[model samples]
Target: MTNAAVDDAMLAMREIFPETPLQLNEHLSRRFGADIWLKREDLSPVRSYKIRGAFNFLRKAIATAGSGRVFVCASAGNHAQGFAFVCRHFEVHGVVFMPVTTPQQKIDKTRMFGGEFITIRLVGDIFDQCYAAARTYVEETGGMLVPPFDHADIIEGQATVAAEIAAQLPEGVTPDLVIMPVGGGGLSSGMTGYLGPRLGDDAFLMVEPQGAPSLKQSLIAGHAVTLAKVDNFVDGAAVARIGELNFAALSRFPESQVMAVPENAICVTITEMLNIEGVVLEPAGALSLTALASLDPAAVRGKTVVAVVSGGNFDFERLPDVKERAMRFAGLKKYFILRLAQRPGALRDFLNLLGDEDDIARFEYLKKSARNFGSILIGIETARPENFAALLQRFETAGLGYEDITDNEILANLII
Candidate 1:
């Protein structure tokens, strides 16, 4: 909670790796009309800020519980990798429990980091089930459980980022605003706890995935609230409930400061950063940067802003899905369920309605709803979003009956 503790954590972190860079980003600066600096935590050895908390937790644990104690953690993403890295660094035994559904890339990365020091167990179909199993194991074995973000030690460790930021900023230059992504709230709480007093509470903005607005809903309810359903598209940041300790640190902030960004919209940012800026960002990592595009230009114009680029643990296999979501969010792609007469020329007529720039991405025949008509699912992609309007106008003139299912979650999930 104190600056001295965070400073000590920051100093101790050098034994692991030097500070990640704080670099001025020209593309973001010009686009937002603000002087933007990216605190590139994605560049860390573990490819995230998770290592800071994991290291701090183990350091203090070994000092109090002795080096022989076994450390255990449950995670499917960055935290597991960080815990594994620290375990290998300290030459201590560790047990990592990950969901069975976790990608093999993440599991392999964690194994590589811990080497012989860590034992990984793929348990349960989801994180909650895996976490429950971990708790039972810890109870039976008396192994120390390293929570991803709820504990005081974890918060103190994440606070090191703020310490580094304070030292890394140009002398006599204060940031006008700091943008951070919020999941279980460890990083956001730690950063705000350390810098809130120095920069004033109003200087911070917290972003969350729209599918998992735990912090925003909690703040609105005046207490921590758990979401009943969560979309796991942004796996790294789709926390159903905000951590109790983390919420306490962030509760004072107004609800207005917490922005919930759509998962598809975040993919747009991910693709843009990768294609335009040569910066690959995971869905959660792109949250802060994605929120920048939605902010009022006047609010950040000519001001010094800092956006935390959280992590880059992206799987190349998901790139196609990311691109699809991005295109949908940008309105460059659409899916329609069209009705056509059951005749040979019907297909030609429907094809004629599409503009020159519109390209067919998918064409599926569902079934004949009537003897004279057939239901067809069609997906179209175009270079410009405006092309869809003209194509739809042509369809109306041609008397083609169609229903846009691009935004219909239920139908899209079941069919598309």
Candidate 2:
């Protein structure tokens, strides 16, 4: 709410950790032709901005309440780890409720951070359900509930990220733009709160995962909108609804200022950041950078831009899936269901139709005993997206009966 409050939180945070770097990114600068800087919150001890809010909330709570109050929270990933880390820092007992479906990597990380200072309860399958259980637990036990993004203290704490960006910029010069990823809007709103009065509204660009456009939808509807469902691929930023407090801070911005990045587009950014920039970013962390590709290059060509690289808690096991999604999104990979005549050489004919650049990634045969044709589930990976068009033309010439199921959700889920 106040710059003084955010400033105080930033000062308090210095006791536990050093400032995360605001590095001038040469690669992005050159690629976008903009003076691009990255606020590497990913380099935080807990590898995310979540710690700032969690720590600030607990500090204020303890100061106002007492050291003996049991703190409780619910998070699918990053926030839980942050809460656990903060609990260990203060040597206070904490209870973390996470969805049963949460990745094992996150669960392990939270435990590693909390050690004996916290107890983890695996609750319902999704975040909302898990959050409900956490609320119930807090009510029954009379424990202090630490909300991830909804509270005032949490917003003030997260605002330190903006302060760091402000202080770390060369000569304290203002960036023409500051891009931030929005989930429940904690970090985005917090940063906006800090920057709005200082830089005005025009300096910010907010990004959200396309699969979870809570902030975008809310801004459109003039109220916080709850999504019926969200694709949890961008786990840290796929919130179903923007937090009320967070939305209040962010409501002034027009919906056009916020961009929705596709899940696979985020994967491409994640891969690029890791391979090109030597920066490991989770899907949510890559949201802001991914949205840059959607912007008109002419607009950002000579401007100074700062994009917050929010987190780096990526699991190596998910890298393969990330690549797969990236390839699919690029149109270099596709899935199809082909029906071939039962006669011999039918398979060979279909195979010969594929282009030289086309590689068969998957071939599963489904025999229909009562039908004259056998069903083939085929996945093709090509060197370029255009190669797929040529290959499909060849299929038409061969008179192959097939259906492209790459974008068909039901078929993709059932077969692919």
Candidate 3:
């Protein structure tokens, strides 16, 4: 896409909402020793950069197909809200197909954005099924399908974000590094296409959730590949397959430019941003920011860097899970199975083994393993990670037969 096209899209976007902020984050700058600017796409009307693509797609479609054309799209959350908002903006009718498993908060927000302009259909249990249903509906009704990322107009629309960043920076200034989260590759591809020629391909870093390394895996294989399974914890960036057009735009970059962050690590960033900066970020939205922790300090120090805060469509109900994941990632929390003597003072003995800073988060007694031993599940949270090592040493000294199940996914899922 040309600068002119992106500029035009940006100009039109003003009719819906003014530009989101491009703020220099002092906390991050102090920590990384870099001039870290945040592209606050989280503050968008739909709480994501998804609105830009949806708006551009709808506007161009209406221009060509005329005002009353019906628009259809398939999305789990962010894109659905974006499509709904744009439909309401243009006073056009839209149909949003969402997975049956989508959060009610997202469903309600999408409905609120669309108001009378859109109708929502909950189909299937996953995004792929919902998307297929949307395609079938569009074919039957002969309506325009506003894809989330895979189309030219959508990419051009998302390119406007890069345009805003270019204009928002200090006069005669350019970012030395641009880090962005990747889902279907819409925002990252658009930004890369717009900035690569001027800033060089080496300047961009694309982050994806470790559980769903669609772009990273695709880059490794020199083509898009579908993931066998994806963890939906980072729902916003957990795409199974990168879009074809988006991958084509991103294919020029080296595979190393793409970073896959652990899902639990993202939770740590989310909690930190919320508590430290009073910023709310969903799991996927925290991907880019979380990558900073893994970057070489030398690479970012004294550099002008921009990390796109992609979205803030977080549900408060997930805070506990987020906190738990964060603690686990930080090594401040752990789960274990202990074989205790099924006699008086057995519980007291285990309690005495815990360090002063160690607190019991969960304790469950399972069936008796033998006449004198009982299986017990224990969860402990400590002030510092080092305390766990000391506590485990004490357990060994006491001759306590304990199994650390913290990293055992299957066992933890089944028992803890």
How many backbone clashes does every candidate have? 0, 0, 0
TM-scores, one per candidate: 0.99, 0.96, 0.98
Candidate number that wins on TM-score, 1 or 2: 1
Please write out the lDDT profile of model 3 over residues 18-125, one tens digit for every residue: 999999999999999989999999999888999999999988888888987789999988999999999999999999999999888899999999999999999999
Best by lDDT: 1
Give the higher-lDDT candidate: 1 or 3: 1
What are the clashing pairs of model 1? none
Q: What root-mean-square deviation over C-alphas does model 3 reach?
A: 0.9
Per-candidate Cα RMSD to the true structure, in Å, reads: 0.9, 1.5, 0.9
Candidate 2 regions off by >4 Å? none
For residues 1-416, write the lDDT of model 2, one tens digit per residue. Answer: 89998999999999889999999899999999989999999999899999999999999999998889899999978899999999999999999999898888889999999999989999888777998999999899999999999999999999999998888888957889999999888898899988988788998999999999999999999999899989888988988999998998889999999999889888888888888879999888898899887799998999999999999899999999899888888898999988889998888887788878889999999767346888889999999998988887888888888899988879787878
Instruction: Name the better of 1 and 2 by lDDT.
Output: 1
Error of 1 at 138 (Å): 0.9
How much is 135 displaced in model 1, in angstroms? Answer: 0.7
